[model samples]
Target: MNLVERDEQESELERIWSECGAGKGSVVLLEGSGGSGKTELLHQAAERARRGGGLVLHAGCSPAESALPFGVLGQLFSSVPAVEGPLARLQAPNSPLAAEAAPHDPARGAVAIGPQLALLLNEVTATLLELSAAKPVFIGVDTVRHADAQSLACLLYLVRRTGAARVMAVLTDDTAAHRSPFRTELLDQPHTRRVPLAPLAEAEITALLARQLERDEAERLAGEFHTLSGGNLLLLRALLEDHLACGGVRKDGYGRAVL
Candidate 1:
């Protein structure tokens, strides 16, 4: 499917590139309701960073991992090679203690792994700094509001340290449901920028539908789809799929329904 309405976000991403290119690493906190295209914007930014010869690392936060120390760090460790050595040194091979100390069961594992996890995360931060020295690094964290305390600590540490490092961090959070600690931390930092994603405008929504359907069909469906989804991209797409399945936008019909 074509990306119908991300021109403004694209421009912001380009502006971030210019800032980073000038040796200013920025943290962009993107806040919106669920299905509001925050993740899509991050994906676009990551793609752009990759094309510009920057390293991109993406991680998602889960409620199951909320108590696990370094849960988000572990997710990030699996992606970027720059931190492999430090993480390896921090974690042992097939150790029962390590397995038992997993982040998901932090209450049971915290006594055994808490201190080690903190030290490991510190090492991870240092490693990231080392990697950033060679080239710009882009880190995308999704659902930051659901992130664990330890993971949030690590993120805050990164923001403080990035003033001297070539790393740009992008985070997405559901603003309607929960507030993000990271967002507060970012706002205090002069280098960080917060971008709130609003619902797509009617014209943009029309353009989006047009990319998926012919002109007349797009015009007809766009209004209905916008009303149903409130211009939330994910819901809009789902509604479109439902409409298509119901033959609401047939190739050869103006107002025909299959059922």
Candidate 2:
């Protein structure tokens, strides 16, 4: 995608990424509808952090595995060699010894924190925080609405404790779906910044088309494309490709892409 109408959002992310390197941590939530480019914007931010010598840990969540305990958290830490011991402990299957170690809240009972979850959350947070002592750490999670409960808990714990450290967590949420309670809590924090990504305008659509076609042809097609796609980049790109592939026709390409 061309990133045609996201200059302001990109500038904001650059500022936040720079601040992360200066020992000021903040949470950035990329809120958008499907195909509004949240994931692309997130990758751009992560690349910026990486270029600044920041330790970038990235993860993408899946709805199919949302019930799997600590799935997203495990993905983030799995790449780090230093946290292997704690990561191994977390990756191991459920056992009675681990179950007995977690202290439950008296009023809430055993289901409140789950068995051994609190300990794992603390260990991961502590490890990441300690790592940030030497350099900036960037944690990016995409499609966070589908993150597992335990992973969300650990993320919330780490985010709440990031005030004084060089640790930044960038997350993308699909606004079309129901927002997770944990994700909502993250956005409510004072240091959290929300970047709401919107669909592209007609002019931006024209520009995108102009990338491949002539200016006159792009201008001529922009309105119909915009009307059909509602300015969604993903749909627009597919339509363009279909148009080109089908000898410049828009016969059922969008529907096929949607399918």
Candidate 3:
């Protein structure tokens, strides 16, 4: 998307990068509608952190995996070095789901045992501290609203303890969905920032069309697509791809797209 009209969001992410490097870990909740480039911005920020010698961990939440305990957390830590043991112990012991859960998510049992939860939380804190002790760590989660309960709890726990560690937790979720109590609680945390990405303006869409087509065609497509996709970049790109694939480039003199 080339990050069109995302200056404020981009700047905040850059600030997060700087703060994470300075050992003042931060959490940023990026809120946006679909096609608003929330995930793309996070990916760019992760790339920046990686280029600056930070270890990057990413987890993508989905409905199918929401019921599994610690499912999202495992996706995050399993990629980092030497954290497998702790990740394996995330599921509650003696729970039926524990036996049936995948190997990566030992805490798959729905029921939570107090001691087991404590152990898992402690392990998470210890592992993150150790990982960030030597270098910066960037943890990014996309569609975090669907994150499993156990994982969300551990994330909230870790977030509360990140002040002195060299870590940055970047989470993205849609704004239109039913509000999650966890998100409301997360917003109240200290050292956390919520950045919202707004919809693109008509001119921004025009400029994007200008980048892809000639002057006359750009004007035509910009006007046509602003209506077609309502200034949504993702949808606009998809429409263009479809237009090209179906040989819809031939336009009338009045500049209407020929079907």
Candidate 4:
């Protein structure tokens, strides 16, 4: 997909990165429903970061590992240049920073997060600032709603102090999904922006199809797809693939579907 109806979203990310490169850090919350191209937009921003000689780190939050503390951060910086020392060691299972405990009292049940975790958090914050001073560092996460509590805590801590450093963090998740309790750290934080995505427009869908099909054929199918898909490109692509597999999408002399 050629980034239909997402110019503003992508441009916002660029603006943030440009500001970060100038020693003004920023954060962006990319909100969208499933298959709304949130991940694609992140990748696009990452490409720009890379081209600008900035370091790009990306992690995807998954249900299978959502229970693991600092799991998203581990995956994010595991291969990156900086933060391979204390921050890297903190991700290990045996590290004291990965401790887990739950008190009997529900009010005190904020266990698994203890003094050791505070040290790790400080280490992450310092490392980010130190690295950002040398080169722009862009951190992006997808499906952020599923991120573990520990990762979110460390990120919130970083967000507070990143305003003066050359760093930018981008987080995204399904717009229809309930907000994660962990995101409270990001709430009311300065320099934070939320971007919600809407479904593609009829013209955008037609242009998307025209990339492969002739204009007349693309316009004809776009009308049906716009209605059938409710402007959802993910569903439209799936339906299109199935239609092609069943030989129902064959073109006539005028390039319209034979049916």
Index of the highest-lDDT prediction: 2
lDDT values for all models: 0.71, 0.79, 0.76, 0.74
Which tens-of-lDDT digit does each residue in 92-163 have in candidate 1?
455333442344433321222356555665677788888877878888899886666655666776788787
Please give, for residues 156-230, the per-residue lDDT of candidate 2 as tens digits.
777988877898888998877664466568878888988898888999889888888899999999999888889
Give per-residue CA lDDT, model 3, range 47-129, as digits (tens).
98899999999999998998777889889988765767776655546544343332333243222335556665677688889
Residue 113 shift from truth in candidate 2, angstroms: 3.8
Worst 10 residues of 3 by lDDT: 102-111
- The lDDT ranking, best first, is 2, 3, 4, 1
- TM-score top scorer: 2
Clashes of 4: 1
Error of 1 at 38 (Å): 1.7
The residue ranges of model 3 lying beyond 4 angstroms of the native Cα positions read 5-7, 92-115, 215-220, 242-259
The local lDDT score (0 to 100) that residue 258 gets in candidate 2 is 72
Estimate the overall C-alpha local distance difference test score of candidate 1: 0.71
Task: Tell me the deviation in Å of residue 19 in model 4.
Answer: 2.0
By descending TM-score, how would the candidates be arranged? Answer: 2, 4, 3, 1
The reply for model 1, stretches above 4 Å from the true place, is 79-82, 88-123, 249-259
